[model samples]
Target: MGASCLTDTGHEMGSISLTDTAHEMGASSLTDTGHEMGTSTLTDTGHEMGSSSLTDTGHEMGSFSLTDTGHEMGSSSLTDTGHEVGSISLTDPGHEMGSISLTDTGHEMGSISLTDTGHEMGSITLTDTGHEMGSISLTDTGQEMGSISLTDTGHTMGASSLTDTGHEMGSISLTDTGQEMGSISLTDTGHTMGASSLTDTGHEMGSISLTDTGHEMGSISLTDTGHEMGSSSLTDTGHEMASGSLTDTGHEMGSSSLTDTGHEMSSISLTNTGH
Candidate 1:
């Protein structure tokens, strides 16, 4: 059977196992002579042997018989691994070994990784790796990387990457990297990315990528990312961001960047991203 316990005298009288949620490590027997060596804290040298001939170097030991030498020893690869070691994370400051290393190493590692790669890294790297890394809906990388392309990354990256990366790096990275890494709602603005739902009057009611919607009553609603208030169904609403009823007279738009929808229209309750 597997050794399960350890004694105080520094002996492996039972099995030894370690599992990490951030890194996804599995438990293995540290058997070495069958005496069932007890548990022992990792030392400065980070060298340890077990009865099953298991060897762990530093904190990188993950599999049954693997050796790692870096901050994220068991995270993934060896040497300067990301999050767990080589994994991606919003707050991670190391190299990402995994395929989707979000905000791992580059300045805006998170945004770049999520968008495409090396795109938002430039801007994101400087300020918001955790938040902006995946900011601009992962397209920031292309904008930051190309320096001119502004194609996919530019359109989305420049706007979202710059803002989101600078704010939600830590929180966004954890949640996205964990599972929903591709969600459009980059910032905590509560608006779906690509889709113009952030606005009222059914913005992007048809297409996606912050385009649809035509009303001044729904300021900050991702309304005029392309179409300005001159589009349609809007009165003399201020240029700033605001939220209110889609009727003839709505609240005056403010300098703020959040809109709350009202009634007298097709689905009220609007919230925009800020002019």
Candidate 2:
């Protein structure tokens, strides 16, 4: 449809229906406004509808799925029932879901994942499939998840940190690797966990760790090893230290400060030494 207009023969087509009817390239350049619909207007940049890479990547509204390379699926969205291009898509190999991830080349994957309205992708991921490689990688270069948010009802609302870590919940991991001021690099639940099944750093159960700054938001463990509290670990300007709190081991690229809110340190260890 090369920019459809009042043809030589003025024929009125109120509903320009193209059901399963395929059209070749050279389709109209579509009015910059995708919603110009009184005349059922359509803008198709029909440049080789397959892998060859179509120059017209902007197929404005209704629904769109890539049929070629140079695809910018992220900028557009699909609403037709099962409108997902790839269950897991990325320039890298490893797939990610629920969790966000990145490659050694610094290619940020699954940058963000969340169940949209319908609660589809509950645990968003930066990577596909949601699981960081089980390798001892970079502080920031290594695979990581940011948060596992939950909607009030508590049915696993949303968690960026929980996606691929395999943990039920996660906070933030401001990394010390990139030049972007600060990034998070702290927790890993790894691929088979529940909300309460994760602990922070050495706890093995997310007993308690730092949430960006070092503040104890929950009850500290009366038993556990290597638990040392820092001077500003529990009390910050925006946050206050409750009674029972735990400090994260400052070893192996861990948090220098942490805290929990209403969380109880059920089974953890705390030594007088600072990791």
Candidate 3:
């Protein structure tokens, strides 16, 4: 008399039911009462203790946030204790599209004063602020294209990827995890300026310098080019340089020297073939 339930070949038939029935069907350790769970299906595939229901009825398809509301799936608190209510929520965080918050329980995800925090692509960070694509934590710092607290798992598509230009790839914040104070600087091949030839004829910023030309070509750098930049060499934290036949030079690198005697100066266009 502990608990009872009758099954018709894995199918509930008659008025037979129990407190909690443990039946192994379709590789699912199922527990059925008014709620059928433990199948690792329809979401609730984790350690859950909800008296409602779970609706994990999907498999390796795409990004999903299964919440078990009156029957939230993943790790959701339905709040309302209405019985026999089958309104299940989906919150699957283990998903690799770098799920993050998909399954949010209002307060836990944020607070009751706030709605479900994470779920849709536009719902991750407070959408009222902006259309955030990266992780929610990044929202705390702020972003334009990339996220705040995201990894390759989330930003493997280049949208949130940093421009490996040795500089801090992301915004400085109280919660920026993957931050580098300029290490692997990006190197972009400069556009062929003269003769439409990939080779530099030592005419302008020749690929081959005069042994003291720093041998650096097309690389970005920050050198006081005698131009006397305003207030600061560079107002921003990002790197800059004189893109004269070159794009990137290196750390604070500048033109070697100028032949003051009737020297023929060629024109090199300024360009950024971003990485």
Candidate 4:
């Protein structure tokens, strides 16, 4: 099944099964099934599929299937289970994916999941996640992220997690974590962080954790932690650490911890046997 140069109208191609299928130029509503090879290209729009087992290629205003092999460029909302072999890009203005439950096992390079101008992303829930060699950036002004949970995940080789430039973060929880040569930075100006908790963590090889630059912080707790050849800093100007409890235990080696840059700390507690 191959279609091309279909211009200036809405076309619906449904229930197709073929090898080397292509839909290009102003075709809409593509529903296909049992395709060994398929490609939809160049200014095609709006795909709605049910059980379309395809090695699919979609670009520019296209929707995808339940078992689609590859999807790229444009906005799509998929429910049920699917495996994507390539990548998915949601890089148009006013594009959003809401209430998605699926698993993606592939390498996404330079993938912009959500970076829209003058728009806010809705709540997201992800389970059983892992990534290698890419940076996940959620940096937008005046945006808020609801509760995020990561379980049994690992990162390597200088991956960074940044949420900066006046954005607010809700509750974040990490459990049984390990990082190598990675950094977590949250440097937002004039904002606040809700309660954060971390447990059973290990960091090696000069990893740094910083939360700085003029903001307020709520309750933070770290338990059973180890940092070797690393630095932790929390320095800000004209901010306050609200009525919360900060505790550190069982730390070794020549470590440096500082929380001083003309800010008011309500209550602080440091209890350990060694430095």
lDDT value for model 3 = 0.20
Q: List candidate 3 stretches off by more than 4 Å.
A: 1-42, 49-100, 103-129, 132-158, 161-275
Off-target runs (Cα >4 Å) in candidate 4 are 1-131, 143-155, 165-179, 191-206, 213-228, 237-254, 261-275
Q: Candidate 3 at residue 137, lDDT?
A: 21
Model 2 lDDT at residue 236: 19
Q: Residue-wise lDDT of candidate 3 within 108-206, one digit each (tens)?
A: 111111122222111122111111112222222111111112121111111121111111122111111121111111122212111110111111121
Runs of candidate 2 exceeding 4 Å displacement: 1-163, 167-180, 190-275
Which candidate's TM-score is highest? 4
Worst 10 residues of 3 by lDDT: 193-202
Write one digit per residue (lDDT tens) for candidate 2, span 92-131: 1111223222211111121222221111122222222212
Better of 2 and 4 by lDDT: 4
Could you tell me the TM-score of candidate 3? 0.17
Q: Write one digit per residue (lDDT tens) for candidate 4, span 84-109.
A: 22332222122132222222232322
- State the displacement of the C-alpha of residue 233, model 1, in Å, after optimal TM-score superposition: 18
Cα lDDT, all candidates:
0.23, 0.23, 0.20, 0.35
TM-score of each: 0.20, 0.22, 0.17, 0.31
lDDT of 2 at 221: 24
lDDT of 2 at 9: 15
Worst 10 residues of 2 by lDDT: 150-159
